[model samples]
Target: MQKIRYWVVGGEYTSTDFETLIEGTERVVGPFESRSDAERTWRYLSEDHRPQAQVRFTIAQEPQGTMTA
Candidate 1:
Protein backbone atom coordinates (compact mmCIF):
# COMPACT_ATOMS: atom_id res chain seq x y z
CA MET A 1 0.00 0.00 0.00
CA GLN A 2 1.06 3.61 -0.71
CA LYS A 3 -0.05 7.06 0.32
CA ILE A 4 0.46 10.44 -1.29
CA ARG A 5 2.09 12.96 1.01
CA TYR A 6 2.68 16.60 0.13
CA TRP A 7 5.54 18.66 1.50
CA VAL A 8 6.54 22.21 0.78
CA VAL A 9 10.13 23.38 0.53
CA GLY A 10 10.55 27.08 0.98
CA GLY A 11 12.97 29.85 1.96
CA GLU A 12 16.70 29.85 1.33
CA TYR A 13 18.92 27.04 2.50
CA THR A 14 21.09 29.48 4.41
CA SER A 15 18.18 30.96 6.37
CA THR A 16 15.75 28.05 6.53
CA ASP A 17 15.39 24.60 5.06
CA PHE A 18 12.58 22.09 4.59
CA GLU A 19 14.02 20.14 7.48
CA THR A 20 12.47 22.70 9.81
CA LEU A 21 9.28 20.62 9.41
CA ILE A 22 6.79 23.40 9.97
CA GLU A 23 3.33 21.98 10.44
CA GLY A 24 1.69 24.84 8.51
CA THR A 25 3.99 24.52 5.54
CA GLU A 26 4.61 20.82 5.22
CA ARG A 27 1.30 19.09 4.49
CA VAL A 28 0.19 15.49 3.89
CA VAL A 29 -2.52 15.26 1.25
CA GLY A 30 -3.99 11.79 0.69
CA PRO A 31 -3.61 8.05 0.30
CA PHE A 32 -4.21 7.74 -3.41
CA GLU A 33 -4.18 4.23 -4.86
CA SER A 34 -2.54 5.11 -8.18
CA ARG A 35 0.68 7.00 -8.90
CA SER A 36 -1.12 9.13 -11.44
CA ASP A 37 -3.69 10.14 -8.84
CA ALA A 38 -0.95 11.07 -6.43
CA GLU A 39 0.81 13.16 -9.03
CA ARG A 40 -2.39 14.97 -9.84
CA THR A 41 -2.94 15.96 -6.23
CA TRP A 42 0.63 17.18 -5.97
CA ARG A 43 0.18 19.33 -9.06
CA TYR A 44 -3.14 20.83 -7.99
CA LEU A 45 -1.88 21.84 -4.57
CA SER A 46 1.30 23.36 -5.98
CA GLU A 47 -0.38 25.43 -8.67
CA ASP A 48 -0.64 28.54 -6.51
CA HIS A 49 2.55 30.47 -5.77
CA ARG A 50 3.30 33.45 -3.59
CA PRO A 51 5.89 34.77 -6.04
CA GLN A 52 8.29 35.75 -3.27
CA ALA A 53 7.82 32.64 -1.21
CA GLN A 54 10.10 30.02 -2.67
CA VAL A 55 7.97 26.93 -2.36
CA ARG A 56 7.51 23.62 -4.07
CA PHE A 57 5.49 20.47 -3.44
CA THR A 58 7.01 17.01 -3.26
CA ILE A 59 5.75 13.42 -3.24
CA ALA A 60 7.02 10.83 -0.77
CA GLN A 61 6.39 7.11 -0.95
CA GLU A 62 5.71 5.21 2.23
CA PRO A 63 7.78 2.16 3.01
CA GLN A 64 6.12 -1.21 2.74
CA GLY A 65 7.42 -2.38 6.08
CA THR A 66 8.80 -0.89 9.24
CA MET A 67 11.46 1.72 8.67
CA THR A 68 13.48 4.21 10.68
CA ALA A 69 14.20 7.86 10.06
Candidate 2:
Protein backbone atom coordinates (compact mmCIF):
# COMPACT_ATOMS: atom_id res chain seq x y z
CA MET A 1 0.00 0.00 0.00
CA GLN A 2 1.14 3.52 -0.62
CA LYS A 3 1.77 5.57 2.48
CA ILE A 4 0.45 9.09 2.08
CA ARG A 5 1.76 12.22 3.72
CA TYR A 6 0.18 15.58 4.28
CA TRP A 7 1.64 19.05 3.99
CA VAL A 8 0.68 22.66 4.47
CA VAL A 9 1.48 24.69 1.37
CA GLY A 10 1.02 28.23 0.14
CA GLY A 11 1.65 31.70 1.45
CA GLU A 12 1.17 35.35 0.53
CA TYR A 13 -0.22 35.61 -2.94
CA THR A 14 -0.02 38.49 -5.36
CA SER A 15 -3.77 38.91 -5.64
CA THR A 16 -7.09 37.81 -4.19
CA ASP A 17 -7.58 35.50 -7.16
CA PHE A 18 -4.69 33.41 -5.79
CA GLU A 19 -3.34 32.54 -9.20
CA THR A 20 0.26 33.33 -8.35
CA LEU A 21 2.42 33.50 -5.25
CA ILE A 22 4.99 36.15 -4.43
CA GLU A 23 8.64 35.38 -5.25
CA GLY A 24 9.95 34.83 -1.73
CA THR A 25 6.70 34.28 0.09
CA GLU A 26 6.34 30.61 -0.67
CA ARG A 27 5.92 28.64 2.55
CA VAL A 28 5.94 24.82 2.76
CA VAL A 29 5.30 23.28 6.11
CA GLY A 30 6.06 19.64 6.43
CA PRO A 31 5.14 16.08 5.51
CA PHE A 32 2.80 15.26 8.35
CA GLU A 33 1.89 11.65 8.94
CA SER A 34 -1.76 12.51 9.36
CA ARG A 35 -4.16 14.94 7.72
CA SER A 36 -5.40 16.10 11.12
CA ASP A 37 -1.92 17.24 12.07
CA ALA A 38 -1.53 19.11 8.83
CA GLU A 39 -4.92 20.65 9.32
CA ARG A 40 -4.00 21.79 12.80
CA THR A 41 -0.97 23.54 11.45
CA TRP A 42 -3.00 24.99 8.62
CA ARG A 43 -5.54 26.46 11.03
CA TYR A 44 -2.82 28.05 13.07
CA LEU A 45 -1.12 29.55 10.08
CA SER A 46 -4.37 30.80 8.60
CA GLU A 47 -5.55 32.37 11.85
CA ASP A 48 -2.14 33.83 12.54
CA HIS A 49 -2.09 35.55 9.19
CA ARG A 50 -5.73 36.50 9.12
CA PRO A 51 -4.83 40.20 9.16
CA GLN A 52 -3.10 39.85 5.80
CA ALA A 53 -5.66 39.52 3.04
CA GLN A 54 -3.10 38.03 0.71
CA VAL A 55 -1.85 35.39 3.08
CA ARG A 56 -3.23 31.89 2.66
CA PHE A 57 -2.58 28.24 3.43
CA THR A 58 -3.92 24.86 2.34
CA ILE A 59 -3.54 21.18 3.04
CA ALA A 60 -1.89 18.94 0.43
CA GLN A 61 -1.26 15.22 0.24
CA GLU A 62 1.44 13.20 -1.51
CA PRO A 63 2.43 9.57 -1.78
CA GLN A 64 5.35 8.46 0.34
CA GLY A 65 6.06 5.21 -1.48
CA THR A 66 4.74 1.74 -0.67
CA MET A 67 4.76 0.27 2.78
CA THR A 68 5.86 -3.27 3.46
CA ALA A 69 3.43 -5.56 5.23
Candidate 3:
Protein backbone atom coordinates (compact mmCIF):
# COMPACT_ATOMS: atom_id res chain seq x y z
CA MET A 1 0.00 0.00 0.00
CA GLN A 2 1.10 3.57 -0.59
CA LYS A 3 0.58 6.52 1.68
CA ILE A 4 0.23 10.14 0.73
CA ARG A 5 0.74 13.08 3.07
CA TYR A 6 -0.76 16.44 2.31
CA TRP A 7 0.05 19.52 4.39
CA VAL A 8 0.19 23.25 4.35
CA VAL A 9 3.18 25.52 4.79
CA GLY A 10 3.81 29.07 6.01
CA GLY A 11 1.55 31.14 8.20
CA GLU A 12 -0.96 29.12 10.08
CA TYR A 13 -4.33 28.91 8.47
CA THR A 14 -7.51 27.50 9.90
CA SER A 15 -8.39 23.95 9.02
CA THR A 16 -11.37 25.18 7.03
CA ASP A 17 -9.20 27.42 4.89
CA PHE A 18 -6.67 24.72 4.33
CA GLU A 19 -9.34 22.24 3.38
CA THR A 20 -10.74 24.61 0.83
CA LEU A 21 -7.34 25.16 -0.68
CA ILE A 22 -6.68 21.45 -0.78
CA GLU A 23 -9.96 20.82 -2.56
CA GLY A 24 -8.93 23.03 -5.42
CA THR A 25 -5.30 22.00 -5.55
CA GLU A 26 -5.61 18.26 -5.00
CA ARG A 27 -6.12 17.58 -8.68
CA VAL A 28 -2.82 19.17 -9.56
CA VAL A 29 -0.91 16.54 -7.64
CA GLY A 30 -3.31 13.75 -7.00
CA PRO A 31 -5.19 10.79 -8.38
CA PHE A 32 -2.01 8.83 -7.72
CA GLU A 33 -1.85 5.11 -7.09
CA SER A 34 1.42 4.66 -5.17
CA ARG A 35 3.86 6.27 -2.82
CA SER A 36 4.30 8.88 -5.48
CA ASP A 37 0.90 10.12 -4.39
CA ALA A 38 2.61 11.75 -1.47
CA GLU A 39 4.84 13.70 -3.76
CA ARG A 40 1.91 14.95 -5.74
CA THR A 41 0.02 15.93 -2.61
CA TRP A 42 3.03 17.71 -1.21
CA ARG A 43 3.67 19.58 -4.41
CA TYR A 44 0.10 20.74 -4.55
CA LEU A 45 0.10 21.87 -0.94
CA SER A 46 3.49 23.51 -1.05
CA GLU A 47 2.99 25.30 -4.34
CA ASP A 48 -0.29 26.70 -3.19
CA HIS A 49 0.78 27.68 0.31
CA ARG A 50 4.51 28.35 -0.05
CA PRO A 51 3.93 31.87 -1.21
CA GLN A 52 2.19 32.63 2.07
CA ALA A 53 4.89 31.08 4.21
CA GLN A 54 7.75 28.66 4.33
CA VAL A 55 6.73 25.08 3.61
CA ARG A 56 8.35 21.78 2.85
CA PHE A 57 7.59 18.07 2.67
CA THR A 58 9.45 15.71 4.98
CA ILE A 59 9.10 12.17 3.77
CA ALA A 60 10.46 9.29 5.73
CA GLN A 61 10.65 5.74 4.49
CA GLU A 62 10.87 2.80 6.87
CA PRO A 63 11.92 -0.77 6.26
CA GLN A 64 8.46 -2.19 6.76
CA GLY A 65 6.58 0.92 5.81
CA THR A 66 6.79 4.63 4.97
CA MET A 67 5.28 7.76 6.40
CA THR A 68 5.51 11.54 6.35
CA ALA A 69 7.56 13.11 9.11
Candidate 4:
Protein backbone atom coordinates (compact mmCIF):
# COMPACT_ATOMS: atom_id res chain seq x y z
CA MET A 1 0.00 0.00 0.00
CA GLN A 2 1.08 3.51 -0.74
CA LYS A 3 0.77 6.38 1.70
CA ILE A 4 0.15 9.94 0.56
CA ARG A 5 2.60 12.62 1.52
CA TYR A 6 2.70 16.38 1.07
CA TRP A 7 5.37 18.95 0.36
CA VAL A 8 5.61 22.69 -0.02
CA VAL A 9 7.27 23.79 -3.24
CA GLY A 10 7.94 27.09 -4.97
CA GLY A 11 10.08 30.17 -4.67
CA GLU A 12 10.89 33.50 -6.24
CA TYR A 13 9.69 33.51 -9.80
CA THR A 14 11.30 35.28 -12.67
CA SER A 15 8.38 37.64 -12.90
CA THR A 16 4.90 38.37 -11.60
CA ASP A 17 3.52 35.92 -14.15
CA PHE A 18 5.16 33.17 -12.02
CA GLU A 19 6.08 31.12 -15.07
CA THR A 20 9.66 30.39 -13.99
CA LEU A 21 11.51 30.24 -10.72
CA ILE A 22 14.86 31.87 -10.30
CA GLU A 23 17.71 29.33 -10.34
CA GLY A 24 19.10 29.70 -6.83
CA THR A 25 15.77 30.72 -5.35
CA GLU A 26 14.05 27.41 -5.96
CA ARG A 27 12.81 25.83 -2.71
CA VAL A 28 11.09 22.61 -1.68
CA VAL A 29 9.93 22.55 1.95
CA GLY A 30 9.25 18.98 3.17
CA PRO A 31 7.34 15.76 3.27
CA PHE A 32 4.64 16.63 5.75
CA GLU A 33 2.42 13.97 7.25
CA SER A 34 -0.78 15.90 6.63
CA ARG A 35 -2.23 18.64 4.45
CA SER A 36 -2.84 20.89 7.41
CA ASP A 37 0.79 20.68 8.44
CA ALA A 38 1.87 21.50 4.92
CA GLU A 39 -0.59 24.39 4.88
CA ARG A 40 0.90 25.77 8.09
CA THR A 41 4.34 25.71 6.53
CA TRP A 42 3.01 27.22 3.33
CA ARG A 43 1.41 30.04 5.26
CA TYR A 44 4.60 30.82 7.14
CA LEU A 45 6.72 30.85 4.01
CA SER A 46 4.20 32.95 2.11
CA GLU A 47 4.04 35.48 4.92
CA ASP A 48 7.79 35.56 5.33
CA HIS A 49 8.24 36.34 1.66
CA ARG A 50 5.21 38.61 1.46
CA PRO A 51 7.31 41.61 0.66
CA GLN A 52 8.50 40.02 -2.57
CA ALA A 53 5.84 40.30 -5.25
CA GLN A 54 7.35 37.39 -7.17
CA VAL A 55 7.66 35.03 -4.25
CA ARG A 56 5.11 32.23 -3.89
CA PHE A 57 4.61 28.78 -2.39
CA THR A 58 2.17 25.92 -2.79
CA ILE A 59 1.46 22.45 -1.44
CA ALA A 60 2.16 19.35 -3.54
CA GLN A 61 1.18 15.76 -2.84
CA GLU A 62 2.78 12.46 -3.80
CA PRO A 63 2.37 8.77 -3.09
CA GLN A 64 5.01 7.18 -0.92
CA GLY A 65 5.77 3.88 -2.57
CA THR A 66 7.78 2.16 -5.21
CA MET A 67 6.31 1.73 -8.69
CA THR A 68 6.17 -1.63 -10.39
CA ALA A 69 6.76 -1.84 -14.06
Candidate 5:
Protein backbone atom coordinates (compact mmCIF):
# COMPACT_ATOMS: atom_id res chain seq x y z
CA MET A 1 0.00 0.00 0.00
CA GLN A 2 1.18 3.48 -0.81
CA LYS A 3 1.69 5.95 2.03
CA ILE A 4 -0.08 9.28 1.96
CA ARG A 5 0.41 12.47 3.94
CA TYR A 6 -2.32 14.88 4.90
CA TRP A 7 -1.77 18.45 5.99
CA VAL A 8 -4.29 20.77 7.61
CA VAL A 9 -3.93 24.37 6.52
CA GLY A 10 -5.57 27.75 7.27
CA GLY A 11 -5.28 27.43 11.02
CA GLU A 12 -3.61 30.80 11.36
CA TYR A 13 -6.25 32.24 13.67
CA THR A 14 -3.71 32.66 16.47
CA SER A 15 -3.12 30.01 19.10
CA THR A 16 -5.91 31.20 21.37
CA ASP A 17 -8.48 31.53 18.62
CA PHE A 18 -7.54 28.21 17.05
CA GLU A 19 -7.74 26.50 20.42
CA THR A 20 -11.19 27.92 20.97
CA LEU A 21 -12.37 26.81 17.55
CA ILE A 22 -10.93 23.32 17.82
CA GLU A 23 -12.12 22.71 21.34
CA GLY A 24 -14.16 19.53 21.69
CA THR A 25 -13.40 18.71 18.07
CA GLU A 26 -11.61 15.67 16.75
CA ARG A 27 -8.67 15.78 14.38
CA VAL A 28 -9.45 17.98 11.39
CA VAL A 29 -6.85 16.29 9.21
CA GLY A 30 -6.21 12.73 8.12
CA PRO A 31 -4.48 10.31 5.77
CA PHE A 32 -7.12 9.21 3.33
CA GLU A 33 -6.98 6.40 0.79
CA SER A 34 -7.45 8.72 -2.18
CA ARG A 35 -7.35 12.34 -3.28
CA SER A 36 -11.12 12.56 -3.26
CA ASP A 37 -11.24 11.52 0.38
CA ALA A 38 -8.68 14.15 1.31
CA GLU A 39 -10.66 16.82 -0.53
CA ARG A 40 -13.88 15.81 1.13
CA THR A 41 -12.33 16.06 4.58
CA TRP A 42 -10.96 19.52 3.78
CA ARG A 43 -14.34 20.67 2.53
CA TYR A 44 -16.16 19.39 5.58
CA LEU A 45 -13.82 21.11 8.00
CA SER A 46 -13.78 24.34 5.99
CA GLU A 47 -17.54 24.56 5.69
CA ASP A 48 -18.51 23.50 9.19
CA HIS A 49 -15.69 25.01 11.21
CA ARG A 50 -13.81 27.53 9.07
CA PRO A 51 -16.00 28.98 6.38
CA GLN A 52 -13.81 32.04 5.91
CA ALA A 53 -10.61 30.02 5.78
CA GLN A 54 -9.06 28.91 2.52
CA VAL A 55 -8.41 25.17 2.31
CA ARG A 56 -6.52 23.10 -0.23
CA PHE A 57 -5.46 19.48 -0.82
CA THR A 58 -2.19 18.47 -2.41
CA ILE A 59 -0.93 15.01 -3.36
CA ALA A 60 2.64 14.07 -4.12
CA GLN A 61 3.59 10.98 -6.02
CA GLU A 62 7.01 9.58 -6.73
CA PRO A 63 7.91 9.32 -10.36
CA GLN A 64 7.76 5.78 -11.70
CA GLY A 65 10.42 3.93 -13.75
CA THR A 66 14.13 3.56 -13.18
CA MET A 67 16.56 6.48 -13.02
CA THR A 68 19.78 6.66 -15.03
CA ALA A 69 22.73 5.18 -13.26
Candidate 6:
Protein backbone atom coordinates (compact mmCIF):
# COMPACT_ATOMS: atom_id res chain seq x y z
CA MET A 1 0.00 0.00 0.00
CA GLN A 2 1.10 3.52 -0.73
CA LYS A 3 1.69 5.59 2.39
CA ILE A 4 0.53 9.16 2.64
CA ARG A 5 2.88 11.71 4.23
CA TYR A 6 2.36 14.91 6.15
CA TRP A 7 4.76 17.79 6.73
CA VAL A 8 4.70 20.57 9.27
CA VAL A 9 5.98 24.10 8.93
CA GLY A 10 5.58 27.66 10.23
CA GLY A 11 5.68 31.08 8.59
CA GLU A 12 3.93 34.25 7.50
CA TYR A 13 2.15 34.39 4.22
CA THR A 14 -0.47 36.40 2.39
CA SER A 15 -1.84 33.53 0.31
CA THR A 16 -0.44 30.08 -0.13
CA ASP A 17 -1.19 26.48 0.73
CA PHE A 18 0.68 23.22 0.34
CA GLU A 19 3.78 25.01 -0.75
CA THR A 20 6.89 22.85 -0.66
CA LEU A 21 9.06 25.82 0.27
CA ILE A 22 7.23 28.57 2.04
CA GLU A 23 8.84 32.00 1.85
CA GLY A 24 9.62 32.51 5.55
CA THR A 25 9.71 29.02 7.00
CA GLU A 26 11.41 25.71 6.54
CA ARG A 27 10.11 22.17 6.87
CA VAL A 28 10.02 21.31 10.59
CA VAL A 29 9.41 17.58 10.76
CA GLY A 30 9.57 16.88 7.05
CA PRO A 31 7.14 14.15 5.98
CA PHE A 32 5.59 11.58 8.25
CA GLU A 33 2.53 9.35 8.08
CA SER A 34 -0.87 10.93 8.77
CA ARG A 35 -1.93 14.50 9.47
CA SER A 36 -2.73 13.66 13.05
CA ASP A 37 0.81 12.56 13.66
CA ALA A 38 2.15 15.68 12.07
CA GLU A 39 -0.19 17.89 14.04
CA ARG A 40 0.78 16.21 17.28
CA THR A 41 4.39 16.84 16.54
CA TRP A 42 3.68 20.41 15.56
CA ARG A 43 1.85 21.04 18.79
CA TYR A 44 4.76 19.80 20.82
CA LEU A 45 7.27 21.77 18.87
CA SER A 46 5.23 24.96 18.89
CA GLU A 47 5.70 25.16 22.62
CA ASP A 48 9.30 26.09 22.08
CA HIS A 49 8.85 27.64 18.64
CA ARG A 50 5.79 29.73 19.08
CA PRO A 51 4.57 31.39 15.94
CA GLN A 52 4.52 35.18 15.75
CA ALA A 53 1.48 37.33 14.95
CA GLN A 54 1.65 36.64 11.24
CA VAL A 55 3.11 33.17 11.56
CA ARG A 56 1.16 29.98 11.93
CA PHE A 57 1.66 26.25 11.79
CA THR A 58 0.83 24.45 8.58
CA ILE A 59 0.50 20.87 7.53
CA ALA A 60 0.92 19.66 3.98
CA GLN A 61 0.26 16.19 2.72
CA GLU A 62 1.41 14.01 -0.14
CA PRO A 63 1.09 10.43 -1.17
CA GLN A 64 4.32 8.60 -1.69
CA GLY A 65 5.67 9.03 -5.21
CA THR A 66 3.02 11.64 -6.01
CA MET A 67 3.63 15.37 -6.28
CA THR A 68 1.61 17.32 -3.71
CA ALA A 69 2.23 20.87 -4.85
TM-score of each: 0.55, 0.87, 0.36, 0.87, 0.40, 0.55
Give the lDDT ranking, best first. Answer: 4, 2, 6, 1, 5, 3
lDDT of 2: 0.89
Per-candidate Cα lDDT values, in order, are: 0.53, 0.89, 0.43, 0.90, 0.47, 0.66
Q: List model 1 lDDT by residue over 1-69, tens digit each.
A: 434433323322222353454445555665566667778877776675435244656666655653334
For model 1 the TM-score comes to 0.55
Which pairs clash in the backbone of model 6?
Answer: none
Residue range with the least summed lDDT across 10 consecutive positions in model 2: 60-69
lDDT (10s digit) by residue, model 2, range 1-69: 566888899989999999899999999998898899999999999999999999989998875564355
Select the stronger candidate by lDDT from 4 and 6: 4
lDDT of 6 by residue, 4-50 (tens): 88888665544444344446565467787777889888887666555
lDDT, residue 38, model 2:
98
- Regions of candidate 1 where Cα sits further than 4 Å from its true position: 1-23, 50-52, 66-69
CA RMSD for every model? 5.6, 2.6, 8.6, 2.7, 8.1, 5.5
> How many clashes would you count in candidate 6?
0
Steric collisions counted per model: 0, 0, 1, 0, 0, 0
Runs of candidate 2 with Cα error greater than 4 angstroms are: 64-69
**True lDDT of residue 62, candidate 5:** 31
Query: Candidate 6 at residue 46, lDDT?
Result: 64
Error at 7, model 5, angstroms: 3.9
How many clashes in candidate 5?
0
**Which residue pairs collide, candidate 3?**
10-53
Q: TM-score of the candidate numbered 6?
A: 0.55
